[model samples]
Target: MNNEAANILLVDDEPNILKSLGRVLKNYSVTTANSGPEGLAHALTTRFDIVVSDYRMPEMDGIMFLEKFMAIQPEAIRIIVTGYADLEAAQNAINTLGVFRFINKPWNNLEIINAVEKGLELKRILQENKALADQIRQQQARLNEQDAILKALEAEEPGITKVNWAPDGSIILDESDIDDDFKF
Candidate 1:
């Protein structure tokens, strides 16, 4: 639903499943990988906003693949699409892999679509929040620097309570500015 099309990666060893999922996510920029290793390779090369992987795969399961994927791209939203209804696997996907959602093998088209949309939305929010957090850190650093400068200025002129600068870039210090009663 976002104006910017999200890049999605769908991984499943089954060709038909990959095709079907890709077709369902036609609105998004989709990449398909046949195996966990292949998917991880692609993930390393390209940044996907959302990744949907089947639970059972050769060499690496969905949980392992998603976990490794997160190591490479922690910002990417992960979703597990599994035919197996293993509660343990679902819990592991959520707890270990930080999966956004888990959809059963015979996923409803609308449900899959909704899940992908929600994943993309979460990705967008995370990116925005990260940007905002970086800005806050930068501002805090600047504020700290300003505070240090003010402290240094006060240290240099202990008696001076107020400093007025003229338009001509000259400092105006008056006798009344001296806080004689104040002790540093």
Candidate 2:
């Protein structure tokens, strides 16, 4: 999806962080939630392409919130922004939770915007992959059904489904040999 059409969610206890991030990402549709529960509520009601959360919060930490958020919207790209940056938090966000980006608390405006754009691109790629996979599955199912039909036809009439190709690469059909029920 394009930036203008993509929906982004920002969850942080600080109003300033939310506002600043919202302002920087004004090109896209942005939703802000003050708490983990509030973020989850928004996740239930809306479909967001990306989610950005703060690591430290009163009730639920960013890791916990993002874990629950993933359950709600598995496709949404996740990000954790924290002032208290630690190796453990970064590793957990990346290795376990599949958080796309870990932004420092004193994040550069351009860096944050770049991260959002990259996250959006990842979402688009994933969505396209899913669509292609679905199409491939549907095509495979159709091929299987056709194979079954051909097999049944062959059982009823031996070599009926076999091709009779001429030297000119044209299909040769014997109209008199084919029954009315076999006509295509």
Candidate 3:
């Protein structure tokens, strides 16, 4: 079971809602958390492709949970599952938390599955971009290190004296009489 198949976290205060939605979105690996704190804890420790959180909860609302989750797993796609459709909070959630989608409660089976799939897709793209950027940075660092090593080698070698105007720009010391420090 490769991770690309999509691992999801379903967070809701209602057990029945979680179970029903989990069953509907059975295509992916689903983990259910009954509270915002529990969900955030799981999210911090485990790797999930997407996090689907209910909008209203006792300890924390969906937007609040999403904000904390974003800090831990910025690349994880956050989907709000809520009955409340308050426009102001939804706007804030999008602006601050960067939620991928908002799904209403009593959700249609097909819509939930679709949202999960799309969220996973976005997460994969974000992860891939981050990996590519890291690889580039590492490669650049290696090149810089190699360049420094070459300069150090050039400076230490007595035979390699730079004659700026000459194409083959260097004085070569005779092999036998070379200083011990200049031996390569």
Select the stronger candidate by TM-score from 2 and 3: 2
lDDT of 2 by residue, 1-184 (tens): 7888999999999999999999999999999999999999999999999999999999999999999999999999999999996988799789988999999988999999999999999999998999999999999999999999999999999888988899999989879776999898
lDDT of each: 0.87, 0.94, 0.83
In model 3, what lDDT does residue 91 have?
80
Lowest lDDT 10-residue stretch of candidate 3: 158-167
RMSD in Å for all candidates: 5.5, 4.0, 5.8
Among all candidates shown, the one with the greatest lDDT: 2
User: For candidate 1, lDDT tens digit of each residue in 1-184?
Assistant: 3725688889999999999999899988999999999999999899888999999998898888888898999988899998889998788779877889999979999999999888878777888899999999999999999889888888998844456889999987675654888534
Q: Which stretches of candidate 3 lie over 4 Å from their true place?
A: 1-5, 149-184
* Top-down lDDT ranking: 2, 1, 3
Q: In candidate 3, which residue pairs get closer than 3 Å at backbone N, Cα or C atoms, i.e. clash?
A: none
**TM-score order of candidates, top first:** 2, 1, 3
